[model samples]
Target: MRGDTEWGSIPGLVRYASERYADAEAVVEGRTRITYAELGARVERSTAACMADGVRPGDRVAIWAPNTLDWIVAALGAVSAGAVLVPLNTRFKGAEASDVLRRSGARTLFVTGTFLGTSYVASLRRAMAAGGGLDALRVVVLADDAPADFRTWKDFLAEGEGVGQARVRRRWESVAGEWPSDLVYTSGTTGRPKGAVITHAQTLRAYEVWSDLAGLGTGDRYLIVNPFFHTFGYKAGVIACLTRGATMIPQPVFNVDTVLANLAAERVSVLPGPPTLLQSLLDHPARGAHDLSALRLVVTGAAVVPLRLVERLRDELRVATVLTAYGLSEASGIVTMCRRGDDPAVIAATSGRAIPGTEVRVDAPAPGEPGEVLVRGFNVMRGYWQDAAATAGTLTPDGWLRTGDVGVLDAAGNLRVTDRIKDMFIVGGFNAYPAEIEQLLGLHPDVADVAVVGVPDARLGEVGRAYVVRRAGAPLTGEDLMAWARREMANYKVPRSVEFVAELPRNASGKVVKGGLRGTPATG
Candidate 1:
């Protein structure tokens, strides 16, 4: 069955799990625990609802909500109905979400109401209104009290009442392994996000290998703290759990108290996220109050993994398997991962060898030196959706994806990611591109020029510090610039520190000397 191409579709995998796992618990959120069979039924009902709403194969459906049972159902259901899933970041402001929805041409949007005191639906509406409206977009609110203007989740599912199960099944059967299942937007140096299209086969196959390599299996309780929008949470977290029949506990946000409570209450054994997440768990004042003994496997990467953190996770936390993996959105969220029983030092220093069926190469200037990491495998994305030029730039004609990350492959085949070839930084696990922030900062009336660089931080691993050249006699202060940036961009993209400069250092070709900006003390 693993060798068959037809079984690699999202729906196909769900069906297989349902049939095999039967009454086994599949998803757990709050007090709700759904069996694999029950999940299958819900997915089918949701698929019918999507088809009733005229969703067709290749159509894009956007989901803009935090991690919840409904998020999983909506995503899988949309794919089952033959629509491509486009996950919008929960941190995205109105304009950012609007840009993705507009570019993806998502006909349907599944959004949540008030969360953390902010109404996502209202925010999106404001953005759409200002940005010429999303063409032919239908809003579906997933809330207990949905606004009167849009369809509620219950109402949306109720639309399937008149539709037959056979129709839904037909749509499910029509989808094949090669069909595009997801369009995940990744930020680039170009200052605009590009949607990396991935197929059902690619996702299922890659994560099957990921699940196996990570030692995921039935009855393992998985707590997913990563955002559902990113490939890390959706693919490696959710999809991996599904394929392995692990019970998934979806965490909406990364609150230490909530996570610790869930870890104790649910007996979560499988947890994966960036190093910051694990660090927070280890650093929390009340961490030992909760019974975290159930934690056995942990996967972390995306930023430098401190040797101390790896040692503590093993010695202090007593986790049996602490694996570090690496990849980008273009490669289905996993290219290389450490195996269980690997040396703690090796796991800390390098992202393990490439997963089965994937190849990693470093285009080094000198032997064993750090260079751009290139990947070639079934895991590679189909391409940047509708952007041939960007696709051509990133992917070689033969197949290797030119991952802009700089890394070196050791003699043992382990990949140690060094600096980025592109000016992108990770802020608490979120990718923040300097060019995008610089572009937004350049729009300030008092700003004459600006350059952004990643600076080391105690908490977030790396944060952006902007070096700004103000207009002559301008009264712009760093505080004022940051305040403006907070309003204009996502929280992670906003510069944590700002420094005023007489002039930005530039080279002969007139490029901002980002190297010179780093380590410079923040001004104001």
Candidate 2:
């Protein structure tokens, strides 16, 4: 059955999964294990808490945290109470996250206290500058312990106890499939991130197709190494599991040894993440020490997939199914997917055919030629949140979405994405936009100008390389600038190397010639 038809809304799915798979294990985070029944009860408490905290239908609720059971419960609880979810990237710095929450006018925020040795609450407070920037946000709940002004997870949940389950059920049942589910923010070539508004119906239908294509089943132990903020992890990993009753083991950070330990300990059967993750596992020196016979499904994309990698899984690990897919945040994060029984060569070369109800086309000379990929489907987003100009530019009046990705459509209907028209590249698994990085680099006082380009990396698939022009009389060095970048942005976005140039190459129109910058010599 179509997920939308079966459950109608996410709240409906939560209720059904709770009843049907009550005793089945739902999530495993370290020593913490929770059954489907426990997850449902937790979600219900969260929903009531949201209502108690002034969350209403159509309000925007944001969560800035990693992949954990608390993140799942807090986000779902808000959605069940009819608030549109806005998932912030855990890698984003305080200013980056603050900007989104301010733009979205998020009514409440659920954040982690400290993660990876940094205090997230303090970071956001610093970025907010004495709370002057966030007037809309009424409450801040911490997943760990409450600070001076914020509420703790325990205290937050206790407030909902006064609100009965009957009232919570009414709030959950009031949600319709047509209501907006999430506002997924994605940066474009313009150097600003825009939120893509996706509806409940689109999310449900898309991931249902994802689960069916990936062959997910009940009781399958899934180790989700992908960050929950990305659509790949949240929908394909979380939402897909809800439909199939699979066990979720969310790994907050990507560590090879931790992944191996979880796989062997939990008998993980489904592992879906970027190609780099699988490649790391295949090359890990300690891989043979773990009993990995139980691993059966692997879904990877966001970078090139070598045919040898596919062959190795079957030959060495004995995985039954391995698939690749293509998607973007604007299209509900799915476009095409490789089926279960596809040939290894085809799976490596193409992203398979379009989903059941969508149409794919390319503006090119012929089938083999490359062009801008266009899609029209139920999966396309409503539009960029409150930005009609961007919506008009992205969507045609005839209903086709102008995907900025460059791709070639074969005669067999398979899509092979070749390049990015927006100059976006995937570093490990994260999308790195050159324009965004260049803008950030321009913030340095000693830098006269900057241009960033994607450079080939053996391990990360791609990393940023910046060609910079130093201001006259400035004594800044490449080593000094790179260290500055580490403190400024996410680690993946920091350029691996930098080169000082006298001037940047540009055309008559004055746009930076990135192709020339891509050839600039690195300092190392």
Candidate 3:
């Protein structure tokens, strides 16, 4: 394959990979293994299916499924047919997913059947019914048996039967580098999720640099434990694998035993996830029995990495390369990454220097002080999908994106993330904005006021702890609040602990002083 400049569109990249590594294994999931040639063919057929369904250029297509080979094909196929892909978090409850789908105005949805005993299709139906129905959204289920109302995976693929291959080729060729590729929704400080619009060229170029820096190469087996809905798994995991000819092994969920078995069975060479994933593997009793000798590379970040975790990954796991990277959805999921051979202390202390063509600036009050991190680069998102006011608030008129993260830049340009200016805390690797959690907590009848803040944890790097003020005569407990939160939001967003107080500290402006609640005693 040619260098970065050659492939502009994702479909173009897939074509390039097929030609360069025709018979090479491209995807491995359970009993199925697909070659690059077959993968490319399937993507083309999927593109044709989308076209036949009247999916026009710039149309929004949503995928709400777990990590699987079908997810890759559907996403690539949709993008190839000039549709902007919108990935819904598998962890999202029906209402949450509906909000995103409704906001993005997605015209079509591709989902899975029962997984882990949760019927995603049923959840979606309930959400739509509750919201008075989605706007002409088409649903296609990728499983053996879908509801009578929806189309199955095979049926969806058959939509392309009558469409000519030449038509699909024309659609693929029509897509330009600057076209919108994916609309990934991230929760802002305002307590609502906004879609970050990223272009095809930006994504392809960014991950190419990522693949090179990480030393990913042909024939390397990559076990992707990261969820495909996020940029880390889709752009870095799938796109990076395609760009470098590495074989992708998609793990739907993160289980230590499954990961170990896949690593040894596939001779996995590259593995990337949050620190908790690696920690679990290290702590698992059966870890030593698994043939993890083939594990050669590891990439971890998204929370504070204890120096000991880094040391153990190398010393105990015997991995040759371990890298830490930092980026958000607005920046195409990468801003800086530690190089292959950097010192472990450096990897743990800072997220490495900005990638090529990207610049990082700290808006500090004085030298060496932490401030909001500003990023300007090719990887910067176009803007939020349609919310211009929200987009304007994030990106400056000139071009810099206000990351809402408070961090400092070293003399060498490495970024050290210290705190969040937006009060967004990462739980196990997922971002949980405090405003969103507080909004839900305030709805309880017995709660008079609530404030949420993040506290350090030994397992999950940080978990939310809420401080609440009970009504004068109401009998309310911290456990009651916790139970209510679990039903109202995603598991990661639920506060692990709650503290009931008689009153909450506030400033003259009436804003809750989050700092005062940080070290408060927990009632749970």
Candidate 4:
């Protein structure tokens, strides 16, 4: 690896993979299988196209598409051209996509027409109509050939000759001006989304450390189901394969039947995802129809995985190489992970240890008790973009990142997460941030004031519930409020129930005493 082996930089590692395993399969989606040599060729072609299209060093190229071969190709291409890559989540609506695109100041965008029943092109058109036109966005490349206003992928790829080897070599040798790579925008749980500036050095370090621990390398097959917009999919899913020359099987869209078939068809050796994704695969009625005998390693984290689901993968699926890791976007996703070949008890009980070269410390511990976690390593982000005050509050001057998570590291160096320090909760293992719910709840016509709290549940661990003060003239019942929430949010994020009250209990500073409502017997 000639490039910076830090967290954010993985281009040099990709170069290494191409050199070492040039003929091996790099990306496989549907009937398309691209070898490392072929993949690198595509990356080079796209990089040339990017440069020809006026993408420059430090420029932002937003990849706004679902998980597809083109998404990975565009990401690597933009990075190779010395442009920053900003991956947009497919879940975002037109307004959300426009906000991210506008904030990122992207010069070029690669979009898709359709994805899993979602009309992506329609959304983009709507975004443009809403005044967030692609003014700075000079080039728009469509992933699939369709009758759209954008150019086709083939035409885009042909813009640059594949003979820019000299230019690429020079740029690789003196890859200055830009910092390997940069990922902006935080998956906001609070107010608005702030860009978290992660340098290439920081990102590469996180991937290298994790790849070593997970024992990934050439000849290994890894199936990636998570979206690349998130850290878990980008670092662990994509970079892990590139750095180690392992085969990467990307799913354009998540389908239980499709995944099950691919796992068997590809003979995938390693599988990693959030608990819900894995559970859906295992619980699928057709899961047993596939031959998954080649599966050896199974890694999962992000949300609290049910013990039963873990045990089922082990007992029923016959996968012995099972491990779980913990991380946050701020830490580049995988600061701590269960070591390979550990005892089943340890694997199930703890989130493993801090990855090698990363420092993990708990601040504000209450006399032998664990408090908030603070991390220092190449994995931590540089800072929150353009928000010095918020950055100062979250990141210490000494470069330690405040994780806002409560966890204890036992004497054996294993970490056990207890709860979050902030007012947030997890529903069905997905983070149901309280601020977002409060914002949505406030939109109710009859809602005067509202506060959201997490209540304990056996199946989901914690489910969100709302307490509200209705407007005097507005006729809003608890049932109506609950129904309204269900219409706006994903099923898991919808509150289980709503309680209408005259007023909510607030402290001297106007902060609601949410703890008081947790175990209250009264509904209102």
Candidate 5:
């Protein structure tokens, strides 16, 4: 936290990390462990390759692959060559891929032929052919040798490829003027996802804050199972590892056994996963069989974790520290993180106060209550790419980002999230908090998990409907669940109907897909 310098750009962050930990392992993909020295060389070669193929400053170069070394190379390569990287979600279908590609106007895409059982090249080809300003597509670099309209990684990197420590430093100096490094598309829950234009300065500041707060250093190793498409993966996983000189264990997808095994094998010190992943790790019968003694820090977000679950982690897992982060794509990932030394109540119920440089304030408090969460920080994005109206909606005239979430700050300055402004509904002229209902429903004996949503009603104007996942071997009908809720809550708060499900639909980032569940019947 004491380190001070004027270099606030992402390329600068890469330079600093490379200089500090030149020979240290920067990333590990299965058997391949690439040191910062090697990482710099690869990024340099990859950047030169793109530049040779006519990519210029501000050109959009997309990485349309799953979590792999090639993904990191391409991302860093694009940034180094003064091209803003656009990362497409690997979970996206042809249509979704096409929309993102066309909208971003990416000139080149570094792709992996087949990753996680999906043919990325095939989908990219189809998407490109369907068209919009993608005809200028110059090169496609494949990680593995697959016969196609493209060059292999070895061949591509041969373009003006230079080696040595001196060259890596020189390559970084060439692109230091480029402010914004990546154009990332936020997972649009409503309408087409707009790209949050993140600058190099913004992203570096985010990683700096993260590195300082987590006390990360060259000795640490991070297990990154999150997808590269999300901000958490980029800022928390990629940038955090780079800034701190920590080795990154890249996983293409979340595999419970493999993740646990890697933590032991890699001796991973920093671990970040969604609550769902943590729940599985804790619930696994083989959990005690594995070695997690090396695991020191655990951080989670993307959803409100249950207090009981957090308590179990602290008590049973014997973790040194556990933190819950509150972030958004617009803010370059982390705005606030529950401090490692925070109380269990704050750790369980809130995402804690803003990080050192960020400012968080309530927009409009309801007479003696919480209000909409507003944030202002260097980490905040310049604006949504090419959508002035939507950009205006999020960024206020005073520069504060009006995050759609509602929260309250206690006397200690810990921020407790209450609900989403968009999710809140008026019921009988009174606002109903779906999160409150869902939290209560989650406490039911038969309920494994629950999500509450507002539905249009002829009489009540809008009423609550509950979607639940029953605990294993527990049987609870819709009527039984409704009756149980009625006994525990007031008439207005009790769910009018209940639907049982195996699991809730979630986005790539693991947030519940509430919009997807809107039109379904009361019981499934």
Candidate 6:
């Protein structure tokens, strides 16, 4: 768990993990339990499939699916074959998903057949039909039943029969630590989603620090509720488990009942997610029925973490370590974290001090004052994918990353995040950028203008509230707008409440003054 020097690349780590923890359990899904050796063999088969399907080193490969055994294998396999992995948000609607695939120039896609009763292939086809569609994509492998022309998962793996084991090993071995491992697309204040290019070394080193700090060990059973499309789920949940030989039980959704069931059934020992998840579990009336005694470690963040949350877990569930952290995709999804055995007040109030090999500072002149948060460290990403202008704008000449977050750093160097410079909100654990939501809402024919702001919610840390200006004679109601929005974007990105206005307030610079809109009272 040292760093890149210990395991040259992700593939190397996978190989070593497979051998070191070979007999130990790897992934448990329903009745199936895959050992480390078995998981390695599956990843190799998937890597061979990628090779057979013409995926070359540095080629972009996207996966539009949820957290499952297949997702773990497909993603790891693509990276092992030296392909740059691009994971699509499972919550994204067809058009949104297609937009990323088109922009990333992904040559291949591994998608689930149907999830939550939606046919992904059908969804993609409809979205693609409206536009030029994905003409560059040469392969579409479905985890379930195959469509007319698309290949099934079994068939896709079968196609790799011609590829020998030696060739697969060589391809993976050639993947250097410096090579870009994945392009995680994240939306910022600009409303346009950009891919953050992170290397295998950065991911490994950062998560190695994360795993060690959290005391993740070989015998731990982890319940990964975070979406795989997110950095927390893929890197922290999956990658960290690989490093420690922990068993992963991935839950596709955040249903409270399912989580309770898994905690008792799987004897889940490690749970890491946003504050909303832990809150719901704490409040569930049926909590006492389950034997949650096995849970030892709990890591939660991404919103205002209540001091009671840290105390409740320790008092109610008796979890040994409860830590809070803060991160962004630009910094490999980690910048600061509360160490184990830290003062519960410090862990609850701030995201703790910076990890080793990193520095965190605020733009304000004095300590304990709100200012732009900046990070310069080993965890910083190389740059945005193929966007030099954006990269230059974000990264300083001296290598400090301008994290568009307003925070106050204590004299002790603990970072207390105050606000987002981007006006971003977290719906459950998902990040909902207001600008992105506004852009999508602007597409509605009846909407002439829109502004979105994050309002405090009792359950979710915050939810989006949109103020809109309807077109002349449009007769658009908030209900109608919300209905249309539900069809257009991911559920999390859809604003919970909408208000129709004759015109939106604007500053002299002709920008929709969001600060004014943020104070607008609920009209429903």
- Model 2 TM-score, 2 decimals: 0.98
User: What would the C-alpha RMSD of candidate 3 be, to one decimal place?
Assistant: 1.5
Task: Kindly report which residue stretches of model 1 are placed more than 4 angstroms away from their true locations once superposed.
Answer: 1-6
Backbone collision count in every prediction?
A: 0, 0, 0, 14, 1, 0
Tell me each candidate's TM-score.
Answer: 0.98, 0.98, 0.97, 0.90, 0.79, 0.98
lDDT of 1 at 146: 72
CA RMSD for every model?
1.3, 1.1, 1.5, 3.1, 10.6, 1.1
Q: lDDT for each of the candidates?
A: 0.90, 0.91, 0.91, 0.75, 0.76, 0.91
Number of residue pairs clashing in candidate 2, backbone atoms closer than 3 angstroms, sequence gap of 3 or more or interchain? 0
Model 6, 196-237: lDDT tens digits are 999999989998999999999999999999999999999999
Candidate 6 segments whose C-alpha is farther than 4 A from its true place: none
Tens digits of per-residue lDDT for model 4, 1-524 = 32253322455656677778899999888889989988877777777778767777778888777677788888888887778777877666666677778877777878777776877777777778768656656545565464456777777877766547777655554444237376656645465666677767667767777787788867898888777877777778888788778888888766778788889999999988767667777778887779998887888776666678778888988987788999887777778988877877777777899887789877754533688888888778777766788888888989899988888877887887777877667664466677777887898888999888888776566788888888998877777778877655545567787777778998999888887777754353
Model 2 lDDT tens row, 72-114: 9998999999999999998888878888898888989999988
Better candidate by lDDT, 2 or 4: 2
Worst 10 residues of 1 by lDDT: 1-10
Q: Per-residue lDDT for 1-524 in model 5, tens only?
A: 42224554566766677778899989888889888988876777776777667777788888877777888887887787778888876656555666777788877877777865667677667766777566767557566575566777778777646444465456566665335688888533244568889877777767778877777777888898887877777778898888778998888878889988988888888888777678878888888888888777888876666798788888888778888888877888877888878878778888888988889888664533689888997778899989898899889998999888888887677777776766865454333567756776777888898888888765455689998999999878888888877655435667788877789999999889998888788874
lDDT tens digits, residue span 1-524, model 3: 24346987998998898888889999998899999999999999999999989999999999999999999999999999999999999988888898899899999999988777789989988888887459488999998788888899899999888889899988888889999999999988779889999999999999999988898999899999999999999999999999988999999999989988998888998999999999999999998888888888998889888889899989998999999999999999999999988999999999899998999999999868899999999989999988999999999998999999999988888899999989989898888999888888899998899889999888888899999988889888888888888877889989999988879899999998999889887984
| Regions more than 4 Å wrong, model 4 | 1-9, 132-134, 139-141, 145-149, 161-163, 176-180, 187-189, 306-308, 366-368, 427-429, 454-464, 476-497, 519-524
Candidate 5's C-alpha lDDT?
0.76
List the pairs of residues colliding in candidate 6: none
